[model samples]
Target: MPTHPHSPAKESVVDLLGMLAYGELVAFDRQSIDARLAPDLRRRAQLSIMAAAEMRNYQRLVARITELGADPQEAMEPFVQVIDGFHDSTAPRNWLESLVKVYVGDGIADDFFREVATLLDPVDRDLALEVLHNDDHSEFAIAEIKAAIADNPAVTNRLALWARRLVGEALSQAQRVAAEHDSLTMLIVEGTGDLAKVGELIKRLMQAHSERMTTVGLNN
Candidate 1:
């Protein structure tokens, strides 16, 4: 917004962009790989299309980082470890698990990014919002998960537990990121302006997450 933004604000923007860009890259990779676990050609093709969307978003974000005079790779490097760790720890062991991860994990990720986008300037905020996972893209995964639970209600328990693990791992990585990146953390704290508002934001996110879970016949 300013001709010359404060150093911390600028750095925080770069950091957030970097994190988001890398996240899109990783999302593409995961979606591509997870597509292999799909039960049918149609489902696999759907996931492949979703994966391509993520790559396109990745390009947009990297271009924005370069326009800002930051090296996209360097901007993304600090987050690599934690991001990779999240995927490593939550690798889906089956087709259903992969679907659940895509539905729950990506849903929560988009919600969090949408929340963070509010802290950014108009241009960056729009960019951040653009890269968010589209619920339409997740329709296949959501339908599959819901169908599975409908056919076999007992499946809901296992999937619900898996969903919880995904959320927990995501939150853990977020905490690590906030601790390691001062500027980004400052942006969030300053943007929220108070702990009460921050808690409220969390409540909204959790509520959205719970509704998504319910849609798939899973308990939050």
Candidate 2:
């Protein structure tokens, strides 16, 4: 592992990477499980392929953690309980719910990391952006959701309600993680150069989330 000129920033970067790494790992697991919920073999296979992509992203993050001279598992440990708790509390009961979780829940998280990645140094920023869910994944989810809603408008209200719950839980978990990790908080504050910008950041995330909901024909 090479030494960084800014050790504190390095620690923050490690925290970020660890969180993302665990996220990718869990995404892979969740997608594999949720694929079983798919109504048809085609959708199941498509989801399985997405799960494979997530695993590959996890491997990349783990390799980066190793390059930073940190134990990948150790770096990821701090986030395990929180991430797991979020998933446990928001477990999807059906195929549409699973797709909504993937689209809305995971979409917000990806937006968040993309925003934070801008504050990182060049190499880390690029890696972070590179590992996010691809456009194809988002398009697939949107298409499935829209098709479902179009076929049966009666399901719209229920799915919208589920999306609301997901947003609430995701925000709560994000706050918990930030509050518990001082280095990460400091990184954000320093990067933005103003504590107030953090509030603005949350607003932006929410706005993007709303747009996504609207995109899928769901009410925000």
Candidate 3:
């Protein structure tokens, strides 16, 4: 009998890919809804474009999972509840809040995956980096947020508070996922070669996140 075309992948890779796949899928859904909250048609259309990009990224991740000989849906299943919970808890109330969520929340996630991608095999690392949110989306969100802050200085306090909440919730969810997924945790530990380095990695992620928050005039 012929064997599968690709070699067996590590469990950590599957978990990472699965989590990312589901994340992309949910991002698409959230972006579509967020687009509706856009104050104007141009902004709404921009979000729609970003949402479509998310779906394409999801498809790419699913294809990669299949190539690894795993069921795409099964790979994504484990993360559904965890990811959904994060979204449910962080639901945005208005256009600016929605943009802040996209900028602050999704920015942290992309930063994390980009860091982790360095620890993966070349193919997986490349794919992970490739599927990340494009600069166009980030630029759009940042511009919108800064413009809002400029128009109404009063908006800063509210958005800054919302961003802080997002970071707190995001960190909590990350801890939950790390605690629950042994293979992924092991991958991080092994890649960094020590528990202390893992701590350093997290610090680096948070530091970068703080910079991003500041970039859009939000207090970290």
Best-to-worst lDDT order: 2, 3, 1
Q: Tens-digit lDDT track for model 2 on 1-220?
A: 4344333478888998999899888988988999999999999998899889998889999999999899999999999999998899989999999999999866887888799888887778888788888889889999999999999999999999999999999889989998999998888887776789999999999999999999999974
Q: In model 3, which runs have C-alpha deviations exceeding 4 angstroms?
A: 1-9
Minimal lDDT window, size 10, model 1: 1-10
Report the alpha-carbon TM-score of model 1 versus the true structure.
Answer: 0.93
TM of each candidate vs. truth = 0.93, 0.94, 0.93
33: Cα error in model 2, Å: 0.4
Model 3: how far residue 171 lies from native, Å? 0.9
lDDT of each residue in 111-179, candidate 3, tens digit only: 887888878877888898888888889999999999998999999999999988888887798889999
Better of 1 and 2 by TM-score: 2
Model 2: residue 15 alpha-carbon error in angstroms:
0.7
- Identify the leading candidate in terms of TM-score: 2
lDDT of 1 at 28: 84
RMSD of 2: 2.3
> Model 1: per-residue lDDT, tens digit, 25-122?
89889989988998889988988998899889999989999999999999999999999999999999988998888887778778888998877777
